[model samples]
Target chain A: MIPIVSDLAPLVCGLLLAVTGAGKLFGRRTAQLAANTVLVRVLNDGRRAGLALRAVGAAELAVAAALLAVPGTLLPGVATAVLGAGFTGYLGYARATAPESSCGCSAKAEGPIGVRSFARAGLVLLGGAAAATATDPWWTEAARRPGWSAAFAVAAALLLCAVSADLDHVWLLPLRRLRIRLFGNPLAGAADGPVPVAASVELLEQSVAWQAASPIVRSALLDHWDDEGWRVLRFAGVYEQAARGARPVNVLFALDLGASIDTTSSPAVRVSVIDDDTDEMVPVDLLAGMATRQVLPMAT
Target chain B: MSHRQNDPGRRGLDRRRFLTTAALGGATIVGASALGGLDADAAFAAPMPSLDPAISRSAFAEGRITQIKGSVLEVAGSHGDQHLIQLTNATSIWKLRTTTADQIQVGDGLYARGVDMPDGTIAADAVWVNIVNLYCTVKGIAKDRLHLAHGAQDHAVVGHIVADTTTASYLGGALTSDLSRVRIGQSAQILGAWRPADDAIDIARVTVGH
Candidate 1:
């Protein structure tokens, strides 16, 4: 069993690596993130990035196919090991330079795209290739070895399909559940008491054009809430309309009023009063339409 | 490990010389005979199919053409898994049920049985192309070939128009006169079969060209 698994493991690793390569070529977000690592950043432009990924994917698939088709040969085993070592070298380089930087691998999800994973994949491939080359003869006592090898290869191919999709979320869900169980709350930072009333608010869409009027006006807007004893939150919402443009295209800024706000409902307005201890919309003396456009900074 | 490091030549002479002598003796014996068994094995290096073609043929006969997409045919049987058979200028053509190579098209389902080629593909002798109708647009046109792009990934189907049946109706529009008559931006709904190969589409239709 050990020999069988050892002989088959590299083939399995090669198959998985090929799938990963294909996924990267197809612009999978995870695959893209992986490519975005510092080493890949050396390649300029998105087109080049895609081409590099496709070339790598094709090479990986070819190697895997070769390993399977031409077994009992020392040449393929050595070739696979060389490829693995090259991958490991790249991983090491990435670790040395950008240890904390996000791995912009094509996968949209954030995960540890670290050197360890690459080293693991490489070593597995090398081991399998070596074992396959040095396996027992055809007339060994285990007459069923050939059948078993064929079966394992088929299984590896099927698994390769799943790996290609980058849908390993199914496998990682249990890990997430365990982490959540160990940790009391995942989101401790945002769990503060009732949010303070915003110092000032503006229609974010119009704020852009309004800010262009003067740099001073923009600076004033950013600084106004800092002077006031209130915290501001930038809110954004999307709404579905029965008829197009029926929804109100406006945002209301409530001053320092301790108020309840519904974060979930889109297109629903929440009322808050500045410097007031109630949920009511407090009246303010207008400094023209610009005062209404004044926005409070969250840091303040 | 230390033995090899210390005195490798002694062991090498024993194993290597003995094997070489045995191989030479076997080669001489087979070289001197008309039956020509073991020498042929040394020369060939790889095992060919069994001497009895009937046994190999019987094993190959079990695969059915599971799906067709353009020039690529998918055969599933004896192998117990779908194997893609790529057809090109070099592929030997065959007919279904001993009929001449007619009645073949994209989407024509088939059951093909043949010998497993040394390269691990089936060399089908009998191909039963299943005929199924497909509606797609002319994604691209190359000389005598039309490329139909379809489905989520927008797979491309490439094929030349069947002789004489050149006119085709596109997207519920009137049938155009011929493949040449259809414009680049025109939509086409073709009644034909599709054969799926590796990332390819093979279309065979009775009516095309819109």
Candidate 2:
């Protein structure tokens, strides 16, 4: 997973740092721009928030550009990593003590950029520093075989690593976009992309099991049931069909059997849509028996 | 605190996340310090490890080829360190500690271990090539025909000529043929890379998502 993130880290960090640096070098409106975002509302006053935000953005943008341009040689990597370490440390300290904050850096960006928003940038800077500073074993290889053949082989290997890193982002994301454009995915924009019942049934429900994953994943699963769409009606420990043909509505939040509903009495769930004319409780069991499934993809 | 008093979102960035990132970054720098030096002038070179028969023989363990398909071969053994090994048929197999066959096929991704046979022949013992998993992107597709773009280092990937029943969609359209279904945009976690001969790759399994 870390390696996977590393692939995108360079691109995102480089872009962020370059943009941030440019903002600082040029004008103060970057802060003003951040202040206008809804996500930044969590920070209280947008104008004042904008100041810190602008500094951060400018710093990040510079780091990002440096990361890409700087070859992962020993000296350059160490230098860049040092800068990254210091910057991230400062961000960490600020976050730790601050009362409440929005990651004004990407407050306006779409969908799940985790604390990685900062850490990934930091890692790339550091990793690049490490790669740059570390000695290429090829030198030794060539030393053993004093010929152009040895030289060519080492050159090819180094070139491969560099090119792979450069193309990382487009390799995954652009191709996805291209596939979508050329093929026209019917499942486009659907929650979890039209999951088949067989696949959805495989969702791991045990809390202990789920908690083994990264904290970010666990927290997302716990807090955002609205976005998760599918709810756990009842864990019941084992997969028992309430009825053979009854298709359960895949929801994220599980309902406690006796606490939320009477097993024998009252229809399982009561759905009441508030409209101008009607307000009534629809039986949960009735919907559970319905065959068509509705789900919302969990997006943070 | 001053920034916090004015902009509350600044407070939301957790210290834990920041510290973890910072510490990791710091560690990477510290670690790189010990990994030797890289001279930029000599950056482009292939790393040729010094091969000492005595020491190197100990590093490679004996295993048997349990299965063979294409570019992928499966070998089973208790060797703990090596989880996956990728090799071609042109690999020299003559150290007579183990020998299963005189020559493995082109489609065979073999697993064999023996002393570097003086005659370049690994003696009779064990040989295995375990089926491997490849994560790749579908570069092009035809019904039962798939072209994949995969590989790191050399970017060597295989194209699988198999069609899966799962309806894969990319962008906005529903693909009809295997060719139509696979667009240049989607990525897949493929199971096998069946290289019958030459540089061709045949995919075994294609997994997009659950």
Candidate 3:
């Protein structure tokens, strides 16, 4: 029983390493990861980071091969333990010094080193230590007890997936989504309604008034105030009339909260141009005339 | 406030009437006309352009800085295009703070809005270095690092908290450097600098809670 459990440990560890190594060797994101990996950055130059990543991949594959292919050798087990320890140290270093660097443990994984990363490394180390006590290889043990081997393998793979942050979207996210759907989201009523500030901003951006004045608008939501039945949004603008000498102006849009404007509809928002210095409103007719003569013609 | 004197053939005259009336005292009357004017081209003669694409505006370029020669910068865009940005005395360079032209470095991401010269170079008016604003989920947290997941595809990103620059805003609270209250599994909005070579960021501000 002890020998079988010990033998299974190395098999699991070996499989995990093999998958990781494969990703580093031939993943589409390898170049991007290698270029940013703290381990590679600290040890190698810009051009050499790629070569270093490939070397690490090769080393991982070699360890995996020795653990799986070899019958009952303590050497493979010892090597695995050392490699796992090295990974742990590297992750710790990365977390401390280059906190923004990628772990580079998997092809699809671009996350920073976290607690799960440390746990995964520790698991590998423990597996390697268990393998050192085995008298037979996992394959031999599996042949003797096929049913137990299959169950154990399935359990081990599931555990590995649980520990891997990269694989979370496949299992964890679906489970979370299901739980949320069943129990309901805690943040569902955070804003109390569907019409958030972001939604209002989106509505404002989609308005015809925004389209007409976007070229001159210099700021994003400089000031927003709810007045009576309307939401007044302001932005800094430059009055481009040569007579005004490119003077600063305030562009205000009063959006009616009661009116539901569709995307296909013409905007039902009122636009006003206020003189910055005089604090006087520019005549809407004059600005509309200017927009028709200058802005709307440029649109076509 | 009346459009009685204006010709009905004139475009946007009804819109002006509604706006002028709305500004005065007749809010309900303005609302009725505004709703009716929804499909009227005469109300809004200018068409609203589609705003779905993430394309940068004209005279603006967003990319990674590949090379720098004096006041000139060679940028490689995310989309297979290259831009030559020329810095002038008038150009305002901003990283985490307002900085000078000499602070720009290779392997740094950049967003430059400027004038496109006849010779194809952009004479920059404003240059934002490595600026990235992301809404992300805090997947994991360490002593120094925060593992962030961003975008609809859940792209993993690493965010580093700088000592002086990094501040946190909790529940729409004041920005403070004391981030001991930050927890794991919360959604956060990060304003930071994107490291050019990798999928990492140096966070300037992190706003958590709704």
Candidate 4:
């Protein structure tokens, strides 16, 4: 089993290299994908970074072709090993220098250079080393032990797929969808929990009462309390009267406690302003006479 | 205190209805209000001898909540500053909605606007928690989510698309639910509830070509 596995290792390595090489050279949105890599940081130019990716792709393709055409050959195996080592070193550099950069190990823009990247590169290096020790080509070994060789190939393919983020849609998302279908989402409780305070603020902000009183309101909600069943929201505001330039005042907005974000019903909101020093209500006549400032986007 | 009935059927009812419809259609109400009005046309533009200094001296406290001992929050700012924010019944706490002080979890980012008290504490009137304004590159677009590479530091985030709630603003245009114009590699501004769970954002608005 060990002998057959070693003999077939080169073929697996060739398959991986071919896919990645082809992707790097001809992948959709290649420039955008390359920009996500450390190559852009290294080269300091978008076009140059793309060129560098293509160059690397060419090298991988050459090595892949050699491995495929001359299976079990020591030269191809050693070349594959060298390429793997270079990849590992480059990944380590990329990780340390630009921690946020995608591995760019494959043509796909995988999030960041993580453990999986190093492991995959290490696998290639080890596989190459093992392939170099094989006396027979992969086809010859498969012919001798057909079932074992087929199983080994399938296992290698599964292992590669496990570490490949680009192929996640092919298997991982499906498996995740199945899990969600069988057992409800873990975040359902939090999502279905009581309405958050932000929603109330959203609702209040949308109200015409808020729009009219907003000019005088200065700060975010300073305090809030329940009056009867109504939610009373308070704020620190400056009421600029005709005579008093900017009198520091308290603004209160009252709305139903059960008010939610719904287009069907427009809940009544009451807004009031009180003078801080005089402890008197700011004249509603003044509030009523204030001009409405236009919302810019709405004008467009 | 004073208030007038918000009669939608008053004179200029069409304009009022237009404003209401426009506000409802846009998902960026939180963000737009958060930005605040510049060059505000004061309700009464006039001169006064005694311009109250308290109105001009609004204390602002922004940072992560290091400690939450009941209503008073101990916050550590990014600039090594510490602040004590006091929440009251009138003080509104908003985290994805208007909520109570109990919803404010420790380690959550906070911005408090209030009056400064003599005890070196702020009497917070409004508090917004875990609100994020992120500039991102659209890496992948799914039916239910957007894979984004956010900020210069390159944090990968998942932006969830809530039906009827999430909106898109295109080229400085009006906000709409039609997100067909959103494509991969577009630069966008995401204003939403950035939660710690799964590093995801319940996106309220995505503004592209801004």
Best by DockQ: 4
**lDDT tens string, model 1, A1-300?**
366655665556555555555555564553345454564566656556556656666666676666666655565566676666766665667667765433333223333445435645555456545645646422231355878887766865555433332343344334444554576322223223333221012121122222212211100111111113322321111122335422111112222322221231111122211211121222322223445544555574
What DockQ does each prediction reach against the true complex? 0.01, 0.01, 0.05, 0.08
lDDT of 1 by residue, B122-210 (tens): 54433434323445555445444565644332334564544323333334322232344443334555543334443233333224442
> What's the number of clashes in each of the models?
43, 94, 0, 25
Ranking by lDDT: 4, 3, 1, 2
Q: Itemize residue pairs with steric clashes in candidate 3.
A: none
In candidate 3 the C-alpha lDDT for residue B86 amounts to 85
TM score of chain A per candidate: 0.47, 0.31, 0.79, 0.87
Off by over 4 Å in 2: A1-16, A23-29, A36-45, A57-79, A86-112, A115-119, A124-174, A177-300, B1-210
Superposed Cα deviation of residue A142, candidate 3 (Å): 3.3
Q: For residues A196-284, write the lDDT of model 3, one tens digit per residue.
A: 23234445565555655555554334434455667655555556664655655566777664333332244466777765555466543
TM-score of each: 0.33, 0.24, 0.58, 0.63
RMSD of model 2, in Å?
30.2
Whole-model Cα lDDT of every candidate shown, in order: 0.39, 0.35, 0.65, 0.69
Model 4, A87-157: lDDT tens per residue? 99989999889866877778766677778899989988988887777778888988999999999999999
TM-score of 4: 0.63
RMSD of each: 38.2, 30.2, 12.6, 11.1
Q: Write the per-residue lDDT of candidate 2 for residues A1-300, one digit (tens) a residue.
A: 232223333433454456545654455455545543332544678675666566655555555655555433344445456656765664465466542232333323211223544654455455555434433332342355456534444553443333232343545446555766777753333233333221221222222112111111100111111112332211101112346332211112222222211112112221111111121111223233223322334588
- Candidate 2 docks at the CAPRI level of incorrect
